[model samples]
Target: MISLLLVVGVLVAMFVAFNIGGSTTGPAFGPAVGAGAISKPVAAGLMGVFFFLGAWTLGRNVVTKLGSELVVDTGVFTLTTSITVLFFIGVALLVGNVFGVPASTSMTAVGAIAGLGLAGGVLDFAVMGEIVVWWVVSPIVGFWVSLIVGRYVYDRLDELVAMERSEGPLFTVDRSGSVPVPRVHRTTNRRELAGTATVVGIGCLMAFSSGTSNIANAVAPLVGSGNLAMNPAIALGGLAVTVGAFTIARRTLETMGSDITELPLTAAIVVAAVSSTLVVFLSALGIPASFVIIATMSVVGLGWGRATRRVPAPAVVTGDGESDDPLREGTDTDATEVPNPSALFDPLTTARIVLMQNVVPVVATVGAYLTFRYVPIFGF
Candidate 1:
């Protein structure tokens, strides 16, 4: 019966990992697909590979932290408790996919683990406090950094990355010699090729970052229960993510790809790079990072910065390019101009989105805490 329960727990963990794959693949490869740089299969394949790399390397530290340090008593994570915790995570994922709202799996998992600790009478306040603090801090930092970028250098950067794909396939295989080599098409210019490559490369980077942060969500509870070792758990979790990427990520890919294509390629790259880097940094320090929150904040910062810019009008001249006051009633042609209000960002919409983003984690946290405290389903 013990072995059977452990097997069931691993299956539940895999179910959570499957959901992670489906949700994360879209954000990682959306820009690449939007730019027509790569196909869904390629994106899915790269998502699996880089995610595995991230899990195999930086993701382990987070597993250890979550499985060992969050609770004061590491022994609290019995097989039954682990399964109960994973059940909560799997429910959160289901809610996210079914409702079209993207939430932080890390946040949900941490919340469950914390709840389990709290109920067991051996919770570690210090580790829990630190994780919560970073959860608030990361999103704010992302917003401010992106805001500065949007305000000062957005247009210039936009021009710098003004990319348009030319006609025909980017490369063709030639079997003229003993080996085949890829030959670039004549119509595909250098800039277009470079832009495509950059977009696809950034997608891979996002995949790596997601893998680093998300692997712990799936396997940490089981590892805590001593039902599985670290590497095998990671391997199972990574494989589950891959399964999700290939099978369930198609619809999200279309949706996110379309939305991202409406923006400038550079903007997409900037947002992805900034958000993914933050997640990776947090994951390296044994923290479960929230990818959705950071990405949303970064996007909001970019748009808000660009929209509220004040443009300076040049001076008016009669016959030559001379300094003439246009503010004067006689020569108000091009002098100091009134700044137009670029109130493009909708406050209500942003507020609602942000609010909605918090809902899954909040529910997961409060629900897990309450369930663990009152319910006897897990024998805790």
Candidate 2:
């Protein structure tokens, strides 16, 4: 019976870990993938490696916090608590999957723990308070940081393009004969700023942060029961999670990246940077925060900022009798050209997508909880 219980617990942990990978890989790799900076398979491969590294190196702190520190003076963590927490996380992941919302593993895990603690007379308000504070602050900070950086960086790039265009191409056009001839500049400066290098760096950082923040989801329960040492647990858990993410994370990524926000390269990179930073910080502080929520919110905020900037005003005639509305007489004569590609997917659709992302986890959690709760044959 003891062996059976341990097996069951480990299985549950694996399931939770798989869900974490599915939900997290999108945020880690979506920007790079959407930007065409890397292929999906390559991103997945890189994510698997960095995720393992992050989990092994930084995930330990989050696992300790979840497994041992949330509740106070509890001699033995009941199987009931572990099962309950697992059920909640599973439910949350299911919800995210169904609605296309990238549910935070950290949020669901903490919520489950809090719920069980409340039921078991082990609720720690102070700890809960701190977690709540960070939850609110992390996303907000990410949003503003992303907004500032995205606007500034993109604006600079636009200025450079404008300047280059104004320079008359450094060539001469001749129409002296029946055929028009154009002369091209033999010498041109090639700016080699290593943009790809920066992208690779960000990708690495995002992958590492994802692995570290997600370890708690898969290994915390085992670690909590003192059945597995941290190092070995992380190694095994990281491997399993990486494989699961690479295999099944695409569905969640589509829901978050395509359905929620039509992320351009700039927005995607900013979101990735901010989300990765927030998750790494939380992991260091021994807080289990949701990477999905953090990343999702960051993307949404960036999109929203861009959208507001693009709100259309009433069309007016200029002094030269030309329309300022690009849609009317733009160089590209496509009538359906959307100013903000992100606006193509609105909040309503995004909400629905996010709803799908979250629904699967909720159902799974509820089912697991009920299975453990009502099945007397198992002798829970």
Candidate 3:
């Protein structure tokens, strides 16, 4: 019976990991893919590799926090209870995927476990409080940093990073030596190659951040239950994430790369760097960072700042013996310089994305609480 229960728990854990992969890959690699710096398959491959590296390292800290520290007693994480918690996380993330929005895997996972802890009467208020504080703080930090970058540095960076994809393959094999070495295509300019590399490198960074924060979301329950050791469970979860990266992640890639917002290449890079750094720092402190929320807020901030760029405040408006009507007094060129409010993303679409991300976690938290509180089979 124990063996069968363990198997069931592992399967459920993998289901959660799979959804994590699909939901995270978009935010990690969307900019690179959208910029034609790399193809979707290459992006997926990089995501799998970097994600594992992160999970095997700093990710352990986060796993320990979520699996054992959030609840007063790890004993509450029986195999049945673990499976139930994972089911709520997996289903909630899948709903986000269906709507083409990347959900917060960390938030959903934490919510489920928090619910279980509360229902089982073993909730750790201090740990939960700390996590909640970081969750609130990180997104605000990401937004402000991104906003400053957009307002002061975006235009210059965009011009410097402009990349035009050449007509053919980016690289070709040169078999002149004993080993076949890859060489950049002659048609690709040095600047273009450098820009592409930078974009791809940032994508890898985002993937690593995702792994650090998200790995625990998949396997923490089982790890806390003592049904599976940490290393083996992390490896299994990484494998499931890899599978998801190669498959269902494709749809999410499309949504993020193009549909999420009109994110310029420079803006995307800025957001990725800011959000990824925040997640990694929080994960190192044993907190489950809300990557989706941080990234989305970063996007909005970047756009808002860019749209509000300070053009010449119009000589007429300065009340210098000029006409009172600023619009009529300014040159036609000045009149055409008016900033459009919707320069970066559609308000309605952004609202929908934000709403769904928050709703999924809430649903998971509420559902887990009700199940553990009312269902005798969970042994809560």
Candidate 4:
């Protein structure tokens, strides 16, 4: 029975990891893939590589926090209890996937674990408070930082970063010498090649960020239970994530790439950079960052900043500007009429997306609490 329960716990943990891979890959690589900067297979390969690097390095700190520090007593993470928490996390991931939104894997995992701690009377309020505070603060920081960038710097960067794909292949094999050398295609300019590299690099960064924080969500429960060691747990979770990146991530990639097609590649890159940085920083502090919310708020902030630039001086107070029209198109203005590609942000759709992201985590929190507190099988 003990062996069976341990196997069950590990399987559930893998399920959580698999769903996490599917959920995170879209946000990490969608922009590059959508822009034709990289293929989905290449994106998946990068995700696996960078994710493992992150998990092996900074990810261990987060694992320690989740598997041990969140609850006052690690003994609470019995095989049965671990399975219960992992199940809630997996369900949360499923909910996010079903809704075509990237779920807050870190938030849901922490919520489920917190539920166990609360039910068992071992909850650490101070630790939880600190994490909750960072969660609130990080997204706000990402928003404001992105807003500032969009309002002031995005245009300059947009002009500099040319992400337009050219006709034919980006590289060609030159077989003139004894050894074949890959050379840049004649049709592809330097700026375009640079842009492609930038998009793919940012995608790798996002994957690393996801690894630093998300690995804990999958394996923390099992590790806490003492049935699995940290290294093995991380390896197992990473493998499951890689599998997910190759399989279920396909649909998520399409959703993020096509469904939110209006968002310019520059804006996506900006959001990814800002959010991924924050996530990595928080993970260093052993805090689980919610990338979905951070990225969403960053999108809204970037769009709002870009939109407000067109408002007349008097429009700030009287609300008489063209900015009131949320669905307004085109980037022309009296100033320079610079090509503002990120003016397509829609507030209504963004609000709905934010609402759903929050709802999934909240549901997981409540469901975990109810299950652990009342369910006789868990024996909390």
The most accurate candidate by lDDT is: 3
| Collision count for each candidate, in order | 2, 30, 0, 0
Q: Between candidates 3 and 4, which one is better according to lDDT?
A: 3
Candidate 3 lDDT over residue span 140-235, tens digit each: 998899888887788899888889888887888999999999999999888899898988998899889988999999999999988899999889
* Candidate 1 vs 2: which has more TM-score: 1
Residue pairs clashing, model 3: none
How high is the CA lDDT of each candidate model?
0.82, 0.65, 0.85, 0.83
Query: 2 or 3: which has the higher lDDT?
Result: 3
Error of 3 at 26 (Å): 2.8
Which has the better TM-score: candidate 3, or candidate 4? Answer: 3
Q: How accurate is candidate 1 locally (lDDT)?
A: 0.82
- TM-score between candidate 2 and the true structure: 0.72
Ten-residue stretch with the least lDDT total in model 4? 310-319
Give lDDT: candidate 1, residue 373: 83
Better of 1 and 4 by lDDT: 4
In the range 1-380, model 1's lDDT, one tens digit per residue, is 44888889999999989988988888889888766778888889999999999999999988988999998788878887888889888888788666656767888899888878877777789998999899899999998888888877877877766677788888888999999999998889888888778888888889999889999999998898788999999999999999999988877788773223335678788888889899999989999898888877888787777766645565558687666755444643433324334524557756765776678777877787888888877555
Candidate 3 off by > 4 Å: 254-262, 313-338, 342-344
